[model samples]
Target chain A: MSLGGDWYLALAAIVFSIGAFGLLVRRNIIVMFMCVELMLNAANLTFVTFSRMLNDIGGQSLVFFVLVVAAAEVVVGLGIIVAVHRRRAGATADDLHILKG
Target chain B: MTHLVGPLVATTFVDALTFTVAAAIVLAGAVGVVVARNPVHSALMLVMTLFGVAVLFVEQQADFLAAVQVIVYAGAIIVLFLFVIMLLGVDRREVFGRENLRGQRPMAAILVVLGLAGIFLLGFGAHWATGAPSVAGRANAAGPNVAKLGTSVFTTYLLPFEATAALLVIAVVGAVVLVRRTPGARGPDDQDDAGLEEHPGADGGDGTLAFGTGGEASGDADDGDGGERGDLGHDDPALGSTHERKMTS
Candidate 1:
């Protein structure tokens, strides 16, 4: 059987789902950030697969900017997580109950 | 079968084999990231997953993306994860049963399962992606994955290119604003004179204020406070008091 482009897309979908599942279940802020990075990678895979299938370079082009945005996002997100963890006694997800109301 | 096998068949065999191996690694590492107890171990597992995805990208002819994947995600981001883990002392196994929200785990499982179903419907059960998005002729004129991407980004996507640059600067400045301590910041020791009455919001006020003077406090801690331990808790008065008690004992 020929390996069609759809196989790559399906793999990306599975990875994306795994990332989503991790994001939903995990409590640690850092782990959540890793999950997000995982999701982004899956989306990048989809984009590149479509790029190859369509013989277009634009999807690959979008992946470049997505990488930039992801780097900036990680910088800002980790800063927040670090700040919150430092302010509280424990870094558990439960410790962020200031907005419990 | 052997007589009919040609170069084309061999090429397809290699592609399928590579895809199978890479996909297996990616999925296994992703599952490990979810199930691993130690945050550092999970981070390492995430590195494995990223590397696998990079391999897939290379296979798909996104060579530049594969390089960037290794450099940016595996190189820089994983280092940041390890750094935060070391700084917070959260490298050890974490307690998983200590969820803050009620039914958080169950609800998460349900939502994630639904999300998976949705993705399946889109991926396997749909025909939407049969057509690839059309590209402008001028955009594909540069040739090759890397060069064509460069031309398309600098020309057709120039507006977004400049926009994300601004977004990156904002994110950098925001991170600095969030984490960087101010000069001449107050310390918990200084608040002893004022007392908790004056600053009823002293805990938060002190937490941040303590970080302001954290540079000095950290220096002091490094000078054999608990024999060089408890330096990270230098900014928290609660932890600092506990350290004092520990020292006395």
Candidate 2:
């Protein structure tokens, strides 16, 4: 038998927590984006684990959709990053305060 | 074959060992992604995490997703990230010791720890699998993993699948629009125009700056562009008005 679902779930939780912490603390927008990817990966791992636990193909299907969405998100996000970098070289999340009212 | 064993049976030594190793790789890569000073190193660390997740997927009999995780994530996505890092030349080591916001790191650490504890409690406190089994279809049914996944996606989740296609097309178009630069209309005060002459289309012209047409179009429509332009805008109202005047005339 394979390891229990709880073990995988616990690992995923830790990874997700780390991703969230990195997202909150990191100032570099690209690194921040990577952290988001890490969180999404953790969620994907959970879905796959639950798919095994529940014997349902739906969880995996949902993960497939998530993969698509993540690809889209990354593309647009990086495009925006490139555009921003074009205007202002080496600007970090901390440097972005133009929207402050 | 191994999955056929009932969950009640104790896990084999090999299974435990594999899980232990993969989980270690995953956690180490995750921490590396967070702590790496250079963005390039962070991207490489992300690849390690993705590979570890892929191994876990295979362990869970998600064979197709394991392959997809490797191909799409490790192959395409991380490469794209690296390309951007190299292209933008932002791979320089960042000073991690400096804290722009006081107490931000400590607060984030506390919040993440509390949230993680809550998730663990909630996950383990009750019966983890409360829902009916195989409501969609049996994942471990006798067939190839790809076939089962494809059948489910095409049959039960067809609408969502189609929507994802649309989403992908929109993303491609949005990316192109965002990165496209308008020729002529270089800002005289803009200091970073040193390399602008390299692009064949970017002929130097009047001092009027062609602010991102992507930003302007998004600002006008207020669609998904607001989120992309969250950090972008002319801070000075006078410069903004001048941009507007230049655009109109």
Candidate 3:
């Protein structure tokens, strides 16, 4: 296939879907976090690809914000995970369900 | 040779190499997260995966995003995860092994296959427009990258930017409260018994009595008359003292 705008966008979409699949199917929370990162990076790829295709800078600009969001997310999410581990003494998500039902 | 390897071949090679490396890293880390017996190892693998994806971002020319990916995802965030793991003391003894996959694996596999197929179909079918209106050249493509980002962050997207700050504050507060000990918290002994799974040979040779009748054997050796018998010696009795005379401590 040619490396056209559509093709690039399609590649990004496929990668994003794969990440989403991993996120849904994986039981491990840390794996889920990795999958989430994959999904975000996929979106960033789409942004950059479109930026190059359309010769625009806005899509690229949005990517920076996305990066910031990802960072903030990691900080808070990892904090929660740490808190959970402290309370439970292990980092398994299965242990978390015990508190619910 | 150089003529034979045209820009197309070169570009294709770069793309393929990038994709292969990125995919392998991601998949390996994902598998590690599931298969690794140690949760700490799994978390580290997750960091590796994040780093891999960041590299892919760089390949795609998302420079700003790549930097964020490294600093926020791999650097600061993974360190936070490490901190939590350390505070919990989850190593050697407390790691939970992988749960056996009874019926979940097959269904998960099927779903993944279907998802991939759907993505392929979407890609092949969509009629994507090529020439969209150019928004800007590429965000922060000039000198002072951070300044460009800062200007855009505060100028057009200030509202969302402020909201992000608020979210960060909440996360900080949440972490502090979650890990904070109470003013009258009990000593280490009084702390709740958590994640104390039975592991063989955890405390090796700590001078504690072993589980057996060995104590009876030693008790018989230290009879009441043994003390008086030692008094008969003219010397300090240190010369004739055997290895058993030394305390385990």
- Reference-based lDDT, each prediction: 0.71, 0.79, 0.55
TM-score of each candidate structure, all chains considered together: 0.76, 0.81, 0.63
Q: In candidate 1 chain A, what residue range of length 10 has the lowest lDDT sum?
A: A85-94
TM-score of chain B of 3: 0.57
* Best candidate, DockQ: 2
Q: List the residue pairs that clash in candidate 3.
A: A56-B135, A57-B136
Per-residue lDDT, model 1, residue A75, is 91
Question: Residue B66 lDDT in model 1?
Answer: 94
Ten contiguous residues with the weakest lDDT in model 2 chain B: B218-227
Interface RMSD for model 1 amounts to 6.7
True contacts kept of each: 0.53, 0.74, 0.32
Give model 1's clash tally.
0
lDDT of 3 by residue, B1-249 (tens): 112123344366667667667767866765665456455786787777677767666665556767887887677767766654444333322222344455565676678778778766765676465665444444436655456556666776778878878877886787677656454543352233221112113334342222111222122123422111222122222222222234210
Which residue runs does candidate 3 get wrong by more than 4 Å?
Answer: A1-28, B1-35, B91-102, B128-132, B135-151, B182-249
Query: Candidate 2, residues B70-105: lDDT per residue as tens digits?
Result: 999999999999988755556545667778788999
Off by over 4 Å in 1: B1-11, B129-133, B136-142, B183-249
List the TM-score for candidate 1's chain B. 0.67
Worst 10 residues of 1 chain B by lDDT: B189-198
Tens-digit per-residue lDDT, B1-249, candidate 1: 112224245457778888889999999998888888778889999999999999998887788889999999999989988886655444434567656578988888888778878876665555664564565333335466677777788888889999998999999999999877454554453332212123335467645444333332333333432212333333444555445434432
